[model samples]
Target: MIEIRNLKKSFGSNLVWEDVSFSIEQGETVAIIGRSGCGKSVLVKHLNALMYPDSGEVIIDGRNVFDLEYISLRKMRQRFGVLFQGSALFDSLNTFENIAFPLRYFTELNEEEISDKVMEALELVNLAGTSEKSPAELSGGMRRRVALARATILQPDFLIYDEPTSGLDPKTSEEINQLIISMAKNLNITSIVVTHDIHSVLKIATKVAFLEDQGLHWYGTVEELRDSDNEELMSFVSASEYQIRN
Candidate 1:
């Protein structure tokens, strides 16, 4: 389980969010949603200790991640797989090399082991046989898949997606959403997605965390979100096609 207790963060004199608290159960997919600059990305960064909160704690499994030593924190971070918003692929490297980057850096695995694991990850993302292709050679959706394969090459326990479907068309976005669902169900990995797309949220999230007003305004299941009467949440939803009944 991942527990975020009373977390707060700020930049200079500007407050991003504060006193946020939430817990993500193992094998659950949670979507963090809010308008732009509500600190959705910042909150996810805190999850992996990529950034630290000014106050409070993030307890992953049992240990507070913020309190871990550098070495221990490095090891802890290996448990996470992050798919960045822009795919963040190395244009110079082929897909295979991209996926193998982590294996080479983090493990003592030889060439044969790296090859096998890279292929396995490629297959997991339905991108097998594209290993020789560069990021420039693939479509936007395919590039995202390649990035996903690379992110999961180490077989991490948690998957964090930052705007996974941001630039894709509706059909492609749906495909990515399905892949997110598959990653959680097939791998039993905890999935945390930061997105502004309500359609993607409906397709992928088991739980929803709403960041607003310098705090977590709401945390509940997708079903509860559909039925919620909260003004802020409803106002946000209204901007999308999801209408809440009074």
Candidate 2:
């Protein structure tokens, strides 16, 4: 389980999270939803220790992630698989090379082993036939999947995604969410997603954390979101049709 207590962040004067607190259960999928700058992305960074909170704690599976030493922190970081909003694939690498990148960096596996792992990851993301293809040749959804494949190539225990369905059509967005959900269940990875997509919130979120008013507005299951009376969450959910806008 990941426990966050009284967490806070700021940019000199502008506070992001004020006394924020929440818990993410082991192997549970939690969605953090909010407006563009309401600290959703900041919160996910703290989970992987990419950014430190000004105060409070992030206890992941009983270990305080921020308090660990660099060497220990590196190991802790290995437990995380991350997908950024734009897929963020290296333009210089082909699909197979992109998937093999992490193994090359994080493991001492032989060439044959790396090859097999790359294939496994590609298959996991349903992009097996595109190994030799470049990022430029793939569609938006395919690029996103390649990034997902690389992120999970290590089979990390935790998955963190930022705006995974952003910029995709509604159908593609749902497909991406479905893939994310399938990956989570198949690997039993603890998944934390930061997105403004309500469709993602409704379809893939096992639990939801609404960040607004400089804090965690609400943290509970999808049922709680559906049944919530919180003004902020209600506003977000009801702002428009719950589908991908772009």
Candidate 3:
């Protein structure tokens, strides 16, 4: 489980957010939504300690992530898989090599073992035949799949997706959303998604967290979100022209 308590952060004198608190149960998929520059990305980065709060605690399992030693922190980070907003694949690396990067760095696996694991991850993302292809050779959706394949190659306990569907057409966005759902369900991985896509949120998230006014303005289940009377949340959803999927 992840518990964030009374979090506060700022850069210089510009405050990002304050009094942010929430808990994510293991195996749950929570979508963080807010206006652009509301610190959604910064907030998720706090989960794995890529960013630290000026005050408060982010506890993963039972340990405070910020307090861990370097070696301990490295081990803790290996348990997380992050799918960056841009897919962030190395253009020089082939799919197999990209997926093998984590296994090679974090595990004691030989080339044969890495190959086996990478192939399994590729198959999981349904891109089994594209191992030799570079990121430049794949379509946007295919590239995202390859990124996902690499993200899950280590079978992380938690997955963080930063704008997973940005810049994609609707069909491709849906495909990626389904892939996110499939990964979470199949691996029983806890998921934290920072996205602006409401459609993806409805399709993939069990819970919705709204960050606004320097804190978590709202946090609840998807059903509550759709039926909610909260003016701020309703306005945000309506502004996006998002209709809840029935």
For residues 197-239, what per-residue lDDT tens digits would candidate 3 score against the true structure?
8878888999999999888999999999989999999999887
For residue 34, what is the lDDT in candidate 1? 93
Q: What ranges in model 1 sit over 4 Å off?
A: 242-246
Candidate 1 whole-model C-alpha lDDT, 0 to 1? 0.91
Local distance difference test scores for all models: 0.91, 0.88, 0.91
Model 2 C-alpha lDDT per residue in residues 1-246, reported as the tens digit of each score = 889988889989999878988888888899988888998888888988999989889997688898999888999999999997789999999999999998999999999999998998888888889999999999999999999999999999989999998888878888899898998899998899888788787888899988878888888899987888988778888773444342
lDDT of 3 at 151: 89
TM-score of 1: 0.96
Stretches of candidate 2 above 4 Å error? 240-246
True lDDT of residue 65, candidate 2? 90
Per-residue lDDT of model 1, residues 57-166, tens digit only? 99987999999998999999999999987899999999999999989999999999999999898888888899999899999999999889888888889999999998
RMSD of 2: 1.5
